[model samples]
Target: AQSVAQPEDQVNVAEGNPLTVKCTYSVSGNPYLFWYVQYPNRGLQFLLKYITGDNLVKGSYGFEAEFNKSQTSFHLKKPSALVSDSALYFCAVRDIRSYIPTFGRGTSLIVHP
Candidate 1:
């Protein structure tokens, strides 16, 4: 079974500081990893993905993620944090043969101004 884990329930960072949200996964085969952000009362917004190619993948809103095959991890990172960046972040993983992706419990990012 494919599974994803976001170790921290919450991550706190000061505005303008770098930030990271951790994630790890377990899959039976090749894995497709994804990161998403959710605002209050809003749906999930795609952030970045790791399907192939470079280990570092960039995505919308200045967000990026690094895929590490050996560690089975795909942690999201931002060079700097903004108050507007505060939200719930989720990590998901899907096995190549599966149609559904397994999502983490989501980590709440609190960017203090």
Candidate 2:
């Protein structure tokens, strides 16, 4: 079964500092990795994706991710953090065999102003 793992339950960062949210995935074939952010009660919003191309992929909200095939990891990164960026982040993975993505439990990011 395809699955994702978010090792951290929460990550704390100061405003203006960089932040990272780690994710690891397991799939039968080439995996489609994604990152999503949810603010309070809002739905999961797409952050970044790694379909095909350069390992380094960029997405909304000044977020970027590096897809490492060897490690089966896709770690989300931001050059600087803001208090508004504090939210619940979920990592997901899917394969051609599955139409739905398997998501990690989620990691909460707290940015202190």
TM values, all candidates: 0.99, 0.98
Query: What ranges in model 2 sit over 4 Å off?
Result: none
* Per-residue lDDT of model 1, residues 1-113, tens digit only: 99999999999999999999999999999999999999999999999999999999999999999999999999999999999999999999999999999999999999999
In angstroms, give how far residue 111 of model 2 lies from its true place.
0.4
lDDT of 2 by residue, 1-113 (tens): 89899999999999999999999999999889999999998999999899988999999999999999999999999999999999999999999678999999999999999
Model 1 spans > 4 angstroms off: none
Clashing pairs in 2: none
Report the C-alpha displacement of residue 23, candidate 1, in angstroms. 0.2
Q: What lDDT score belongs to each candidate, Candidate 1 first?
A: 0.97, 0.96
**Looking at model 1, which ten-residue stretch has the lowest summed lDDT?**
44-53
How big is the positional error of residue 43 in model 1, measured in Å on the Cα after superposition?
0.7
Q: What residue pairs are clashing in model 1?
A: none
Worst 10 residues of 2 by lDDT: 94-103
Candidate 1's displacement at residue 106, Å, is 0.2
